[model samples]
Target chain A: MMRRYLVGLILIGLAFALFPLLRQAGVAEAPGPLASAYLENSADDFGAANVVTAIVVSYRGFDTLGEVAVLFAATAGVGTLLTRRRLGKAVPPPGRQGGTEVLETASRLLAGLLIMFGAYIFIHGHLTPGGGFQGGVVVAVALLLGLLAKPDAQVSHRVMTTLESLSGAVYVGLGLLGIVLAGGFLDPRALPLGVVGQLFSAGSIPLIYSMIGLKVGAELSGIIDALKGDRS
Target chain B: MMLEIAIIVAGVLMVGIAIATILTRSLLVSVIMSGGVSLLASLVFLLMGAPDVAMTEAVIGSGLTTVVFLYALSRAKQPDDEDAAALASPPGDDTDGGQP
Candidate 1:
C-alpha cells in the first residue's frame, strides 16, 4: 500500500510538471512550414470547412488509416479475451435484467434520435466539428440501450462483419484511387474540390467519413454483441 | 485556465479511483468504481481540448467496458458464505456424535 501511494504521488507530481509543457504547445505560434502550409492549402485544396478534418483525412490520411486498424485490433482483443474457450468456462447462468420501465421507454424514444444525429455528424464531418468517430460512437450507444433493456437481444454477426469489411475496403480503395489520380495518396484535390465550404465539397472526405462511421458502428456493435453473448 | 484546472483535478480523481478500485474487496464495487475512473479520464480529455479522444473514451471505456465488467462480475462466485457460518460454530460442539 505504501508503494502504491508513493507511485500515485509521483504520477500527480509529473502531471503538474507537464501541465505547462502541454499548455505551451497549444498556445505557441510558430511560423513554420508545417503550420503555414497547413493553414494555406487546407480548405483551398481539400474544400473542407474544418481544417483539422482536412489534415486528418487528407494531409495525414495514412496515419488515420492506421488508427482505424488500431481500433479494429482493440475490438478484436476484448472479444478474444472474454469469449475464448481457453480463458475459462462460461458463466453458470445468465444474469437477471430489469431496470426502470420509464428509463427503458425513454431510451427507446432516444435511440432513433441518436441514430439520426450520428448520421448527420458523419455526413457533415467535413463541414462541422464532429466526424465519423464521434458519429459512429453515437450509433453504438443506441445499440447499447437495446442490450440493457432486452437481455436477449442479439446483434447479427453476419451483418456486422459484412459492414465492417466492406467499409474498410471502400476506405482503402478510395485512398488508392487518390494515389492513381493525383500521383499520391489521399489528395482530396484529385477528386475535383467542389465549391469551398459547401456541403458537397471536400471531394472524398465526406465519403471517407461515411465509411468510417459505418465501420466503427459495426465494430462497436460487434463488441457489445460479443460481451452480451457471454452472459451465460 | 479553468479548463486546465478541471483537467488536473480530473486526472487526480482518476488516479484516486484507480487506486480505490484496486484496493476494494468487493468485486462489484471495484468494477463500478473503475467505470468512474474511465468517465473521469474521458472528461479530462475533453477539458484538454481533444474532443475526439474524449468521445472514444466516453463511449468505449465508460459505456461498453463497464457493462462488460458487470457481466463478468456476475459470473464470478462469491467466497463461500458457508465457511463463515462454519467458523461461527465451535468444532467440539457436535453433541449428536457424543454418544457414539
Candidate 2:
C-alpha cells in the first residue's frame, strides 16, 4: 500500500513537472494543409457533407476496413473466453431481482425508438456528425436496455453471426467493385456522386457506412449477449 | 467569455472527479466518479466545437462504460450493504492511510 502511494505521488509530481510543455501545443488555430485538403475536397469528391465521414469511408477506407476486422477479433476473443459452456455452471447472480414493472415498460417503449434513431444516424452518415461506429453502439445500447429489462432475453447467435458475416462480405465486395470500376480500393466514386448535401449523395460512402453499422452493431450485440451468458 | 469560463469550470470538475475516482474506497463510487469525469469531459468536448467526439464520449465513455463497469463489479465481487456503507463512511481524509 505504501509502495502504491509512493508510485502515485511520483506520477502526480511527474505530471505537474511536464505540464509546462502543454502550453506549446495549445494555440494552434488553423487547420494544416492535409486537413484543409480533406475539408475542401471531401464534399466534391465523394459528396459526403461530413469531411470525417468521407475520410473514414472513402479517403482512408482501408484503415476503417482493418478497424472493423480488429473489432471482429475482439468480439470473437470475448466470446471464446466466456463460452456458454463455461457459464453453464452459473455463478449465480447476486440476488438480482427482476426489473420493476415501470422499468420493463419503459425499456419496451424506448427500444424501438432507439433502434430507429441508430439506423437514422448511420443512414445520414455522410451529412451528419455521427456515422457507423456511433450509430452501431447506439443500437447495441438498445439491445443492452432490453437485456437489462428482461434478463432471460435470448439473442440468437446464429442470426447475429449471419448478419455480421453478410454485412462484412458485402462491405468487402463493395471495396472490390471500387477496385475494378473506380480509381482504387474503397473509392466512393464507383457510383455517381449524387447531389452533395442530399440524402442520396456520397456515392458508395453511405452504403459502406450502413454495412459497417450493421456489422458493428451485430458484433457488439453478440459480445453483449455472450457476456450476459444467456441462450445456453 | 462564457464558453471559456464554462470550459474552465468543467475542466476543474473533471480533475477533481478524477482524483476522487482514484482515491475512493468503494469500487461503485470509483466507477460513478469516473463516469462523472467522462460526462464533464464530454461537455468540454462539445464546448470545444467537436460535436462528433462529444457525442461518442457522452454515449460510450459515460453511459456504456458505467454500465459495463457496474456489470463487471456485480459479477466480480459484490460486497454486501454493510461493507458498502463502511467504505462510503470515510470521505476526504484517509484515516488508515488509504488501506484497510
Give the top-scoring candidate (TM-score): 2
Worst 10 residues of 2 chain A by lDDT: A84-93
**Clashing residue pairs found in predicted model 1:** none
Quick one: RMSD of model 2? Answer: 7.1
**Displacement of the residue A158 alpha carbon in candidate 1, Å:** 1.1
Q: Model 2: how far is A6 from its true place, Å?
A: 5.2
**Deviation in angstroms for B72 in model 1?**
3.6
Model 2 per-residue lDDT tens digits across residues B1-100: 8999999999999999999887777778888889999999999999988888888899889988788777655544456331563443222232223221
Clashing pairs in 2: none
Query: What are the Cα lDDT values of the candidates?
Result: 0.77, 0.83
Which lDDT value does model 1 have at A179? Answer: 85
**Which lDDT tens digits does candidate 2 get at residues A76-188?**
99878766444343343458677888999999889888989999999998998999888988998999999989887677778888999999999999999899989999998
Q: Tell me the tens digit of each residue's lDDT in model 1 across B21-94.
A: 87877777777788899899889888876676777788778877788676554433333232333344332233
Q: Which ten residues in a row have the lowest lDDT in candidate 2 chain B?
A: B91-100
For every model in order, what is the iRMS? 15.1, 13.4
